[model samples]
Target: MKFDNDFFNTEVREGFEISSMMKRAWAAQMEVFQVVSDICNRNGIRYFADFGTLLGAVRHKGMIPWDDDIDISLMRDEYNELIRILPGELPYGFVVAGMYADCERLQNAAFVPQLRVIADEELWDFNDYMKYFHGFPYQRAGIDIFPLDYISKDKEFADMQKQIIKLGMEILGKWNELNREGSLDKFVSEFGQLCNVNIELREDTKNYIWKLIDKVSSLCYRDEADYVSSMALWIDNDSYKMRKKCFDDVIEMPFENFVVKAPKNYDEVLKAEFGDYMIPVKGTADHTYPFYGHMEQELIKQIRRVGFKGSVDEFCEEVASGRLRV
Candidate 1:
């Protein structure tokens, strides 16, 4: 179909196409989860389903038909144990895909028939299955494994986690530099050590918020669910719960499988981050924004990352627009 800038607006770009890219991503994720679960069972690595995955098991008995993601949380030790043993336990087609600890380029990129590489959904070939799709890769599709850390009293812990994430991102920038110079392969290799974090200018500017998150996350923060839900709620403005009054601990609600709890003062938090949570807030209406886009987008779509209230209606005026219960 021929298109113009105005009409083409409904269509997403090459990297964000929902239909084709998502199914492949989720199918790959389930493979990883199943493989990981089997290995964990055999090797004695205890990984209980957490967040949405568990909720899905309870609510939908699988995926939340309309949803597209999964989450499983493991306490730190369990996570570490699984990580330590994962190298040898991978199923025939599954292998590690995380950027930091795994291969520089996907190790199985050429080998595996099905592998989940976390990036834009639009890049994959979705030719045959387009008609059957409802859309994939919508925050609800991928596997998000949240770490459960022990509660720590050290208030600076949050700052520390922030330090860790920021430092890690800075390092990713360094790694990208090698790619920038067409030296990605060389730089990521053991021989490519030529780099620095530009310490002088960034020493004071980097925020330590993630550290706080890590700190609070250690307790799995009672309302951690809200942390994600509230921010997600406003975009579609039509869900009943999204319009209802929120408690700091709404994260405890059972959506599909796991018990969800809210982040600290989530309502107030959403307002702080997104002004007028009820407005037909512009930009791409998805949850993988300002946060995940930090890794990809030229601009942050700032979808419902931290928290969500209702489903897809909050952002659409054609649907009911209820006031937030903060």
Candidate 2:
């Protein structure tokens, strides 16, 4: 199952276009990765590069050439500690962002926790809505930190868990529809009408649903389950699961100019997720992020639509304060 080195070698690997800007974005992510690694090492937290990151390590000895982001996963308990301590442990400009029960768009389950380290906004320069949508500043390059949770071996308990994830996913679909094309007030008004609720009550209901999803997902941790997956992505079967041993230990791998932790059994981890881990896909935009491009006027329009008529910093502040409402 070995791919020829020439097959993986390319001027462009995953259709990211290999520009200076893209290289800077990858560099920025690695900068954040280094900081995250330092914090985890100091606090004795366990984490490993996962998903495309692991693929990149196994195949390229670094970033997958077309890839621009870093992915890492921590087991449940280690994840909790990292989330709790990261805000204080990270340098002044870095922050961790995730869904809070009190935040707007609580029905949105599309994002997971991230360690967002500040980059020059001019460098990444994403649109205001992308930043506003996540309550992160435009200047931040985020390293995604997925939390792996145990899966119950019991059939009944597993069924219940799957149902909760299904319901949460359904709500996420609805949330995306309502928020896809509107100002914050318009989204609230439209969603309230759709749900037959008062506009004021819609947010509370959403937050409650999000809280339940979080609570249901956490229940598996108490059981002595032998398998784990990132339940935040709604895993319901063994296909997404791996032996807990896959993550119980680690080995460091070179990523660009620096070394980062990877699973001790990364070959098995990659094999489980991607059948032919070394094979290059032909002509795919798999590495491109949805929010990577932002024309200046489009960004301005999105900023004004969110009711902000100021700088990116001001817009981010409004979003962070919960005043922007989306």
Candidate 3:
């Protein structure tokens, strides 16, 4: 888990230097990935480095100089199996969060279907924790786990499935907005008619909608399909759609100081995702660089101002209740 200072300070690109803080964040995420890898290995489940992470592994032999997050993909059934077993298997300081995982705290922070394996731990002294971890105080770091589902071979059915998923996502967004605006009754009345189901507003309404979306995304079975894609990302782009054989086997690849699992057909996968995968396209990452540093600093200041010495979950609830002034 310890990285040499030289490694931290080295420039992966000519003009881009990895800050020590960013290096620490990368280390934290690597720990999370290791934990996940171990569990999957023990349980006979398969996963592969995905998207930017896979690109980085094949091209840079480590994290991309600018990217701050790690992504991995699992087939639908294995993804579900991981979710079912992860709760009982995680180490003391780790927790899984997602609509399906039912972790309300982190789920409310970002209502997405992709499961996040977060490093959730308490920090009684924010300064000390920050000095040691060189990352966020609360939920220190995490990795995203996206589910790859089967896509129908028939073009028409596949297109229809895509449309249904798009509509489901729109409905989920509106449901969140309406619930936030205290118009749950209105949402039920309107979308209920659209979905052709009498959805009564309840504590689990959001979960109900999430399940509906997942169900629609998984209408096609893997055994009957020629291609697989990340249903959760279909709303964004079609790059994720590829031949099922691309992930049929995995090969170990160098990633920093560790060897990690990657698809044997990584060349094809990368070419599908990013044309000319070897070319460096240095640009802003999907998230702000140094991931949570700014937000964590703000939270530390707020905690100090209010003289709060409670757990991170309690602080989150206090802020959500509108009783704490940021």
Report the number of the highest-TM-score candidate.
3
- Candidate 3 local lDDT, 1-326, one digit each (tens): 55665654435464688765567678778878999999999999999999989999999998988888899999888988998999898877677866765556656544676788876655224444343343334454789998888988877877877765676577677875767889867755555564567778777777666766777677788777987888866557876677889999999999998988999998988887777989888874766666776676776677777888875435543543345434
Quality of model 2 by C-alpha lDDT: 0.62
lDDT of 1 by residue, 34-58 (tens): 5555776698655544434543444
Compared with the true structure, model 2 gives a TM-score of: 0.68
Say which prediction, candidate 2 or candidate 3, comes out ahead on TM-score.
3
Off by over 4 Å in 2: 1-17, 100-138, 176-208, 234-238, 282-290, 295-326
What would the per-residue lDDT of candidate 2 be over residues 1-326, giving only the tens digit for each residue? Answer: 11122331224646545643355456556667777889999999988998888888878888777666778988878887887787688775455544541234321322432323334343333444233223333345667787787888886887677776655555544665655654444544444453344555354555545445555666775356877877755354458778787887789888666777889988778877777878865333344452355543565677888677787545644554466644
Instruction: Count backbone clashes in candidate 2.
Output: 0
Cα miss at 223, model 1 (Å)? Answer: 22
Query: Which pairs clash inside model 3?
Result: none
Provide the clashing-pair count of each candidate structure.
52, 0, 0
What are the runs in model 3 whose C-alpha is more than 4 Å off? 10-12, 122-138, 174-197, 299-326
Point out where model 1 deviates above 4 Å. Answer: 1-28, 100-102, 107-144, 170-326
Q: By summed lDDT, which 10 consecutive residues of candidate 3 come out lowest?
A: 123-132
